[model samples]
Target: TQASYETTSVYGHGHPLYYNNVINCLRGEAEPETDGREGLKSLELLIAMYLSARDGRRVSLPLEY
Candidate 1:
């Protein structure tokens, strides 16, 4: 899993800024810069895709509950 770690590290996928932001937050030098909206969107999309595949229908984004 070294490759996976490297791919997610400060030098890969252009995630350095986000990584540094997290480090700074951990060090109490700054607050977390991300509000997690992007992560929520990604999770929503994944769930929609899973639902669509499971139910054999087109699933919509921002799924209504």
Candidate 2:
């Protein structure tokens, strides 16, 4: 995932500084806040987005669809 992020930041966007800035803002490249906790939250958020998209419903956070 990190490698893909790196590649996309460079090739897809063609702007490493801007991409890195966004990455840093989003905490993607930083160490996890509490082991797998932050990761689990991200996965849940992603799944909620996918579900909302598939069902054509609005999903709100803390994630209500």
Per TM-score, the best of the predicted structures is 1
Q: Estimate each model's TM-score.
A: 0.52, 0.42
Mind giving the per-residue lDDT tens digits that candidate 2 earns over 31-57?
423446765787789988998999999
Of candidate 1, the 10-residue stretch with the lowest lDDT total is: 1-10
Please give the RMSD to the true structure for each candidate, in Å: 6.4, 10.1
Off by over 4 Å in 2: 1-34, 63-65
Best by lDDT: 1
Tell me how far the alpha carbon of residue 40 in candidate 1 is from the true structure, in angstroms, after superposition. Answer: 0.4
